[model samples]
Target: MGTIYRGGSRGALAGLRRPHLHPVPSVADRLNAERHELAGAACTAADPEVFFDGTQDATDVAKRICGGCPVRARCLWLALEHGEAFGIFGGLTADERRRLRRKGVSAA
Candidate 1:
């Protein structure tokens, strides 16, 4: 591109290397998935910080979002499964999850 001195026949970028392209397949295409478990979750479009800010306002906002989430149960199970030590998930705070764990309450 710097200098095409002999440009009588060749067009622009004629000397450039044409790299091979491999387009990435979509999630469903790759996994044969119908849809993600959290596709309809309310929190997907919300501010991510609201889930992990560790502030009362953030926790409240996150809980409100999780209140109507279709995947709330799955979210809670994942949170408890991983033994998450912080933030809000499935409308519950870390303390709430801790108490549940203390009571030997498994996600069912």
Candidate 2:
């Protein structure tokens, strides 16, 4: 049988890499994380493609869904703060969000 030895020294750990420490989550990360826990959020049940499709028809449909969304404000704020340049968020297209940002709108 091979010999088994025990030592109090940390020499065995010398070649092991230290655990990587992640930085604090950004605002986008926190928003998205909380979004999942949000009850009655409109987008939870809808197809994701509706928001990403660039067609006007899709935009109309997405906007309609967001019209009465309980969390629309938060959704819009997340997209706006993160500078998301694509998709329909909180019933507004990327261009619309750009306009709002230009006008100094920080939240929904």
Candidate 3:
């Protein structure tokens, strides 16, 4: 009979080892999962440039899309709170948001 050793050859060690596995989700992963629950947002699928467009036509398109968004209120509130510097958000353009801020108007 061939001699068998406890800690045999390199091939034997590899045979005993399992494949590398993915790490478990971390806290950030959980948070991201929760946030992604809102992934079905209307704006989420729109062209990113649509919101940042400098032309009136493009901005109008973005606004129309936002007008129907279910999360428009939440989006607008966040933009207002953060003092968003540029781009269209929650159906409001940068200039509009500025005016609203100046007027002390709530995004809601």
Candidate 4:
């Protein structure tokens, strides 16, 4: 068994155990970390056609790659928040994000 302490907070650590008090990263912070990792990769060998060929298939491939990512949701949230109009985020293609925004608007 471990002990948990509420950092920098008085009395917040009371009645808590260490193993149960884990820190969780915020979505924006996590996405920022992932962006750094994904941005430096070489996109040259990647099929430009797959992304730029003006086809849904290209977006599909992009989404597939995002799906495998661990920080997909965070990535998507950050992109949406920042009004990112391109690239794959949160396992969703640009088109998907557009649709999501549209849906949100319609719902409201």
Candidate 5:
């Protein structure tokens, strides 16, 4: 006669230290962190219009600020991942980056 048994606590604990135990943050979380950091820098404005300005040239100013930002990539990744339709992230005006992402998705 033979007996078969499923693994128990030991098996679970064995995998605890595996490299995959901690997963990388999703694009959204990274983006939020970057947003928080950017906000902490005190560049955030009380009015959205002050940042957006409703013109192509104005968007460049936003990008320039983002260029100097430490978390620009994370912010951009989040904006693209979450499909944010408004506000500035990583120094890009909402509309400006949205158009860029739209083109990327469409092209892909």
Candidate 6:
């Protein structure tokens, strides 16, 4: 007589299920993601007053810092997404970003 298996047999189900594999992100990818974050930004080290300043001199200073930012596009996109009402982002003031949104132009 053949051996009977139970409905809850662990051995039968174990072999039928395949192991799930997830690809690990490379160091470069991790670095890139980190680089785009606010913490890694040039503006992070800058005085907060400069970003929110309405004066031309302060705005220019903030823009100069943003001018060479590697993650400028990402910064702009985030600012737009969050509807940031103050500060300079991606070399553009809050008003500028708002205008771009009104024009249907994204940070890209």
Decoy 1 TM-score against native: 0.62
The local lDDT score (0 to 100) that residue 97 gets in candidate 6 is 85
Stretches of candidate 2 above 4 Å error? 1-37
Candidate closer to the true structure by TM-score (higher is better), 4 or 5:
4
Per-model TM-score on C-alpha atoms: 0.62, 0.63, 0.61, 0.46, 0.43, 0.60
Q: What lDDT score goes with residue 40 in model 6?
A: 55
Ranking by TM-score: 2, 1, 3, 6, 4, 5
The candidate with the higher TM-score, 3 or 6, is 3
Query: lDDT tens string, model 3, 39-65?
Result: 455765566556655698898898898
List where candidate 4 sits over 4 angstroms from the true fold: 1-34, 37-54, 105-108
Model 5 ranges off by over 4 Å: 1-34, 37-49, 52-61, 105-108
lDDT of 1 by residue, 1-108 (tens): 132232122321121111111111221121112112356767656765666567888888888888988877877776676565655667888799999999997654
Best by lDDT: 2
Question: Following a full C-alpha superposition, what root-mean-square deviation does model 4 have from the true structure?
Answer: 14.8
Instruction: Point out the worst 10-residue segment of candidate 2 by lDDT.
Output: 13-22
> Which of candidates 1 and 6 is the stronger one according to lDDT?
6
Flag clash pairs in model 2.
Answer: none
Q: For model 5, how does the per-residue alpha-carbon lDDT over 1-108 read when each residue is reduced to its tens digit?
A: 222222133321111122122232322232333344454433343223324354666566656666676666665665555555554665766667767876774211
Runs in model 6 with CA error above 4 Å?
1-39
- CA shift of 23, model 3, Å: 32
Clash counts per candidate, in order, are 0, 0, 0, 4, 0, 0
Q: What is the lDDT of residue 10 in candidate 3?
A: 40
